[model samples]
Target chain A: MTGRMIQRIAPDALAQLSAGRSTVLVSGTNGKSTTTAMIVAALGGAVATNTTGANMPGGVIEAYSRSRARVAVMEVDELYVPAIGASTLPEIFVALNLSRDQMDRMHEVGSVARRWSGYLDGSEVHVIANATDPNIVAAVGTRSATWVDPGWAWRQDSVVCPRCTEVLMWESARWSCVCGLRQPVADYTVEGDVVHTLHGGSLRLELSLPGAVNLGNAAFAIAVAQRRGVDSDLAARRISAIDDVEGRYGTIQVGGRTARTLLAKNPAGWASLLPMLADDDVLIVSINADEVDGLDTSWLWDVPFEELAGRTVGAHGVHRSDVALRLEVAGALPVVDADIHRLAGRLPQGPCVIAATYGSFETLRGRR
Target chain B: MTNRLTIAHVFPALLGTYGDAGNVSVLRYRAEVRGIRVSIVDVLPGDPVPATADLYVIGGGEDAQEMRATELLRADSGLSMAVHRGAPVLAVCAGMQILGEWFTDGSDSRVAGLGLLDLRTDRRSVRAVGDVIADTTGVLDLPTLIGFENHRGATSLGADARPLARVLHGIGNGAAEPVEGALQGSVIGTYLHGPVLALNPALADYLLTQVVGDLAPMDDVRAEEFRANRFQRARA
Candidate 1:
């Protein structure tokens, strides 16, 4: 496989290849691929990036090797951020919100935050972090960084203060701990489709990506681009051009039916994506418990699947029964079908929303 | 008349790291299938722990949140009184670690547990993470239990405690004793975090039987399929 070859040939290739490039490292539990694409689009000048979600160090090396660009924007996996950051010495490091993702393979949220804190401590690298996420604030510490409050949606992983281990108080759109640690004041604030920056004043960002999470990603990407000397309005306009970031929010024609593919890997992702579903939307949830997908489907219980109670639900993929069971328990009647293509054909003739995990999403994307 | 059963999910916002909240859902669903009226009370941090619930369920969480949950649970005299009154409890992973007498963090600092179970957990250099298949011969009336285990703490049971299962496949308890979890009185603790009960229906029925005595068995095709899939994946 190409990955194995890349691992063997150039284990430390990422460092050497990205030496002279103005690298922007984007790392997060979700929206890494989309954010990376948005940043690359905003830069618009000979930027090389891992647009297909191969986000490990080797992937970064491969992306750099395949391109003749002087500027590199790569999506780094959250666990690999420290190692890659140390190697690439990125000009801009973006720390997005931290939440529970792939628990079987990934470190706990607190552990990840601690690792980030250790990596960022006293480092001179300019960092962009989320101000609303307590974990990100704790990780960034006193590091000189541009903090932005795009709005915090998933609070389960950030309820406990990372510094004091005390339950944080959430009020007035901000989180404050009893131990005196609180959400930092943002240099850039995202309020209702507008990004308000400290220096450039306010710029209205009309992003093509749906959901408040995507808007947050756009705000961070535009801030990073602006800091790198890109015009703020131009950056926003370029980011808005990205309607689909590698199959996300894109339409796939399968079995004579066109389905909109949306990816929800973990409970937090599902919490954000499920609300975007329309009331009459025909929903197809595909789950796979492969090695890449964490092999644990218990998080299905944590998702508010009851939101799909009135919708016609169809479960597809390797863990179709598991998805059906969770939906059934949540008061929805889900029809289980292992064959996704066949399931697509059997669905009523209408626009259907396909929510899938990482592996399943890739399979659907490949089909497209 | 449907027998009423109340299940308290303790600190789900804090102690729900590995989808362990599914364990509570499994218990509620299994109970409802047996013609029992189920009511779930989510006891969050700063909320008063209900003194009387038929069952109490706690899930896994991060080390910091686990320590915080232990502190809050220890302060709740109502939970202690409920355990004293023979209420059944199911705790998983970090929840199991905190239900014990004490848990030591990675930095060798120790925090006192709820003292509901006579067990102690110490951090280990190697975090045991993978698929786990345990022999629940004596603990539950099931031949084999399937789940996933991801933890760093090596738990040891005292004289008054017994292991809920033997580690048949993965490294559980992180001890040379070949044990998985501890069982004391009506409390069950385990590191298996496939929402263990969801993959093993008999285990859910066993916990329900502790409260309502004998229970009718329902068709468990989905549970059996889940167990088979997990076993296959574990072997692969």
Candidate 2:
């Protein structure tokens, strides 16, 4: 709202607000909010950030105007990266991994990469990119970038060469296309929990955030902090302090049962987070087709719900049946309910996990 | 009836967007439950497309991958031969477009298809995207077809091709004809990709019956309930 008022007064308000500040902007299909939060934790003091995950141009402008600090770390939506980059002209542009995310709005994965490549090409901003993802490598195209190996768990979107359109050859962890587009040598390679830095030093990232995905996000945050001259060990320590970003990985008590909430907006996210939910005796998943959640729920089929076969699963949301159907086919019986709170009452009184899409997650978070 | 069913999932790397690969999973699950031995072959770009598979499933993908898949499938000619041999084939979205005579690419360039189906696809003024409910064309014993449609082309059927269903809700085929998909011989193509067959079990059974002649009814109560719920929601 502040962003709109400022923009109403001056059209180039984002540009004007970011004029003399040292800003580091981050954008990607996943991990934008968590990464920005980690970066903020690493660069502790008077640092301004949109920690709430409102990553659009308006939200960015609002963050910049509200902060009285000289350094700002903002997470920009993948679609808004070009617009924000043009306005902020940040010292470093962190290009995280791109995957199939909100296809109804973002359109194609390749299209997003093209836009990123167009913005970063020839621009003077120092680029910190993901080396493992073929799409990111193609987008960073010939630009001198600090490549980080955060790992690419989702390979369905990156099967074809972004440049040649030929099938890319994936031999274990390495990928190469016939057009000579290959995974670049990473300046920072993550092996297990330790990130091997470009300077030949290894730093162990012990994040409070669960899942291997968070470790990957921490590597990018550490890279951004190091670029800003923060000590590697100090950055890792600060990053470990962040337990959750927004409602992600947060917990809520429901009907005397503690339900850990997790957010997975797309297939790649579900693929990474589902395994973490495997140990839970009971699980609740909510999906909504609201504008924010991408109205089409067909992507439900892309998720490997088969992994949760024996667990007692509850489905909630506007598209609860759709999710239940997908689970049924995967050999899991899912109980459907539109109201997540009401549905949680029916489940056994014990600890459970709730994984939800954007709109549903927001609704779930609001109930608290 | 063949004791073993080999299903070829063609170009999964290139064309398995939108969870369309779930179609293959559905086929495997439905087949295995019937006590029939089933094997799934994931045919990638450079791999030889098997012409003798009992069933074949192709999926939706982005324009670039769709274009590349079309080229690779065209050169392989295995899919066309399988269709010739009366093997059941299911194609969805871009896969449906790739089986047609011609379709537009991402840049709206007209590209030649495999010509497996007598249809041509051009641009829709607005891309058809949402939940779709259609009535089956009586070729298969099925209930109301319920799934999701997200496509950019308006497909027109030719003399030899017939529509698999008539659209009751969403904009399907993106054509004035109000049809959803095209069918010819043993091949079925549609824009519906709730992995269409998984949502519509009757359609899966129909396809299974085509290859195995008769199918034993499996427990599909949850699937039917899901379909009913979505159908009611789509109608609402």
Candidate 3:
């Protein structure tokens, strides 16, 4: 509501409000909020950020309007990057991995990549991008970029080379196309828990957040911190202090069982979060068709739900039946319930991991 | 008949943007549930599309991958011969477009298709995206076909192929008459991808019947509940 009012009252509010601060814009299909939080925490000073996950122009204006911090780290939405970049004139523009996300609204992944490529082509905005992702490589095409290997696993949307339009050959961690479009050599690479930097220094990222994706996000954070004149050791220390980004990965008590909330809004997100689940963790997945969650539930099939075959599963949300049906196909019989609050009684006596879409995750987090 | 069926998931890595792969899973599940042995062959870009497969499934992709897939399929000629031998093929969105005579790219330039289906696709001024319901009363003998349509191509069918379903709600083919999909003998093309078959089990049964002849019905109560909820929600 405040976002709409800010846009109406001051159309160029973000530009005026962010005049003095050194700003950093983080935008991607997944891990935007978490990465923004990581960067802010690693930077350590009084940094202005959209901690509530408000990433659009209006939200950004509100964040800037509320804080007097000299350093600002904003989570910019993929669609709003071009406008936000122009307004803030950020020193460091971080482009994380891009893949299929909100297709009904975002259209296609390639279109977004093309827009980023056009915007950042010759601009002097120091781009720190994921070298492992083909779309990120294509987006920052030939530009002088401080590339980091964040390790992308979802290759469905990146099968065709964006440069030469040939089918890309991905052999292990390296990928190349016949027409010369390939993965960029990363300046910073994350091997296991350590981030190997270009300068002969390795920082061990002992993050409190679960999943290998967070480890990659920490590597990006450390690289951004290093560019901002912060030591890698200092940045890693601050980043390790963060346990949860806005209620994600936070545990809440529910009907005598502990439930950990993990937010996975797209296929790529689910791919990263699904592997972090223990084999015997009692699971509850919630889905919604609200505007934020993308009305089409077809992307559920793209997620490999078969991995949870032997686990005790429960489906909850407005679209619980859709989640239930997907689980059924994958040989995991799910107990369906529309309300998540009522689902706690049906869960077993293990650490219940609740994987939810955007709307459902917010609702679940609020109840805690 | 044979007790075994080989299903070809064509260009899975390329044309699998949406959850269109669920169609292949549905086909395999339905066939196996009926005591039929099923083997799936994932035909990537460089691999040969098997002509001897009993059924084939193709999915939606980006414009570049769609065009590339069409060229590879045309060169291989495996899908064409399989369709000629009366093998049931299900193609979604971009997959449907590539089987036609031609379709436009992102820049609105005409690119040649495999000529498997007698139709052509041009770019639409506005992309049709939302919940779409179709009336397939006579075509597939199903009640109120429900699926989500997300595409920018306006397809015009030639004389050889016929409309698969009449759009009751959202834009389907974006044609003069509200049609959802195109169908030629044994080959089906549609923009609906609630993986299409998962939401419409009867349609999956129809495709399975084409290859394995008449089959007995299995219990699909859970699937029916899913359809019921989505159909209600779409109507609401």
Best by lDDT: 3
lDDT of each: 0.84, 0.86, 0.88
Please, what are the lDDT tens digits per residue for candidate 2 over residues A1-368?
A: 68888889899999999999999999998888998999899887898899778799888889988888999999999998888999899999988888887777887899899998899885789999888888899999997889899854578788889988988888878899878999988888888889999679999877899988888888898898888889999999999988878978899876667799999988889899987764645888899887887867778888888998866689888888778878877888688777666788887545788989988888888942
Q: Which structure is stronger by DockQ: 1 or 3?
A: 3
Superposed model 3: Cα runs more than 4 Å off: none
* lDDT measured at residue A37 in model 1 versus the true structure, 0 to 100: 91
C-alpha RMSD for every candidate: 2.1, 2.1, 1.4
Q: Write down the TM-score of every candidate.
A: 0.95, 0.95, 0.98
Comparing only chain B with the true structure, the TM-scores of all models are 0.96, 0.97, 0.97
For candidate 1, write residues A152-232 as lDDT tens digits: 458888878899988899998788998888888899888878888768588887878888888888889888988988888
Error of 1 at A109 (Å): 1.0
Query: Comparing 2 and 3 by lDDT, which wins?
Result: 3
What DockQ does each listed candidate score?
0.69, 0.66, 0.85
Residue range B20-134, candidate 2, lDDT tens digits: 8888888888888898888999997888999889999999999889989989888887998999999999999999999999998767789999999999999887877788988
State interface RMSD in Å for all models: 1.4, 1.5, 0.9
Error of 2 at B154 (Å): 2.1
- Each model's fraction of native contacts: 0.68, 0.67, 0.83
lDDT string, candidate 3, A1-368, tens digits:
47668779888888889998899999999999999999999999799999988898888988988899999999988998888898898999999889998888898898899889888864679999998888889989887889898754578888889877798898876999988888888899988998998677888888888889998998889999999999889999999989988898887776667788899878899999888988678888888878888888999999999998756689988888888888988888788887665787886767788888988888877742
